[model samples]
Target: MESFIILIKLLCAHLCSDFILQTNEINNGKRKSGSKGLLFQFIHSITHAGIAYLFVADWCCWLIPSVIFISHFIIDVIKCKCYKDSLSTFLADQFLHIAIIAILWFSLYGDEIKLSYFESFCSVKVWLTIMAYLLMLRPSSIFLNLFLNKWTPTSPNTQSLPNAGQWIGYIERILILTFVLVNSFEGVGFLLAAKSVFRFGELSKAKEIRTTEYVLIGTFASFTIAILTGIAITRLF
Candidate 1:
């Protein structure tokens, strides 16, 4: 349990520093190719190391901060210098950070990890759940988006808030996946009903058949893919 607790703390720190604490100026600076970017990266790495060390609450372990600082610095540098800003790159960056934390937990806790909650990570169900969530979160969204692109209407009435449809699809799939995993088929129905009342009602009332059909197609596709994925994952478990 200690391993799991510490790992969670470390991840919380990472999220706090990497996302919540990071500002637009710092983000833009990190993407630049100069000493200026290096300066920002240095500051960002320091924040990560400091936050992690604080979260771990082991003042005697300077090595924790030292390792975090060096590793984070290198990762950020490589990312900024070698990679473009894309979903894959972002996932890779976060994965490296989390991997570092897992390694750090192992290094500090050693074999004790096996006796504690770290063992859950080694379980097939745990990894399968992770894979399922990953699929529903982004991969499935991209697939649906690309496939639906050809059918997208160019009509002015088809316009909505920027990236609104994408976000809706993400939320809907995630909820559907959760509902399926929990064996709550009716929750999916409630979700679809709610969306129909709130969203489809607007589209249908707009008197734009093309736009309404486009939305319907996307919604049905999203639901089908998410439900299938959830069912597959449950069966695998």
Candidate 2:
């Protein structure tokens, strides 16, 4: 019972920091006004500090989820905005998603929580969750854009990215990959899969086959390079 209460409190704190606080500031135009209410906004922003601030003694607690959540939030935001054809608006949404996901993950799994991993290439649960989110993002975005297009003639033409979004998508994908790599090699395969999507999107943007395919191919060829590097570092340092 006590644990449940603590979880609720933490969750509420995150919610307040991520959504309510940001929305209030936006409505009041505080985000735009720099010097006018800088101190006030600063105080409010501290409601949820960065990943470092949350993961205190338990380093692993901070390592995995922070990278996962932040990376996921950023990718979703960028993709959402690209779909809407509004970069600025999508960035704003991304910022909000970062805050919200950060708060939620911190609240729900802040402690030294143990996650189940089988044979350990990647945990079944983690992979499933990732796939679920990926499916949700692509389909949901397509449906919403289609619905809007059908109802509103003014709506931007929907693009399915016979390839992908643009440079921004590639950047987001890389950041996500780096984050995952930092956490575990089990996710290296996932990163390779993500690269396929990135390349497809890039080809769409570049309008032809590009060196990205080579990069993805090279990525596969160099799979154990990180492990070798890690071993060397351990031996030398």
Candidate 3:
């Protein structure tokens, strides 16, 4: 119990320093080569160490702050130099930092935690949940694309953003599926209402009915599939 509390506090300090304190300018500055980048990186690391020390609130423990400052600075420097600015890089960077924090906590209070606590994740339900999410991404996407191809406009709107619809579908289906899995049908309704409100204006002003009809079919089909998938998963559970 105490170990978990310390872990969470450390994570809060990390979130505050990394996401709340660090700005776009600092993030961009750290990526630059030479002393200019090093300066920003140093400042960010100092902020992290300071916040962590304050959160830990142990005046006698200087080791935590010292290690945090050194490890964080080194990690950020390596990231800026080697990795490009992308989702995978960002996730990997965060994973490394959190892994360090976990290691530090484990060293101090390793005896308090038991290996048996993690055994629940090895169950069949976990794999099925992962499969459900994977299905939401590409499998459902290809299915919808092929089904909607018949209604695809001859003179496709050039003004639309590239792959915007596809990405939007992915996000909405995931959200809808999540809501249904949690048995929150109101969330599904709210999501539909919100989307309808946004589309109503553009749909009403459209000169032709094909664009409106296509959007309606796509939206409803996405919602229905997500809802049904969520229901099926819960039933299997």
Clashes of each: 0, 3, 0
lDDT string for model 1 (60-148, tens) is 98988898899999999999999876657877888898899889888887566545444464454554555566566555665676667
When summed lDDT is taken over every stretch of 10 residues in candidate 1, the lowest stretch is: 116-125
What lDDT does candidate 1 reach at residue 138?
53
TM per candidate comes to 0.61, 0.25, 0.57
Ranking by lDDT: 3, 1, 2
Most accurate candidate by lDDT? 3
- Screening candidate 3 with a backbone cut-off below 3 angstroms (N, C-alpha, C), the clashing residue pairs are none
Q: Residue 192 lDDT in model 3?
A: 93
Worst 10 residues of 3 by lDDT: 117-126
Q: Compared with the true structure, what per-residue lDDT tens digits does model 3 show for residues 15-74?
A: 778866887799899988899999999999999999988977877888878888999999
Q: Once model 3 is optimally superposed onto the true structure by TM-score, how far is the C-alpha of residue 113 displaced, in angstroms?
A: 5.0
Q: Is candidate 2 or candidate 3 better by TM-score?
A: 3
RMSD of 3: 9.8
- Candidate 2 ranges with C-alpha deviation above 4 Å: 1-12, 23-26, 49-111, 115-237
Worst 10 residues of 2 by lDDT: 131-140
Q: Report the candidate with higher lDDT, 1 versus 2.
A: 1
Supply the TM-score for candidate 3: 0.57
Residue pairs in candidate 2 whose N, alpha carbon or C atoms collide under 3 angstroms: 163-200, 163-201, 164-201
State the lDDT at 67 in candidate 3.
Answer: 84
Under the 3 Å rule for N, CA and C atoms, how many clashes does model 3 have?
0
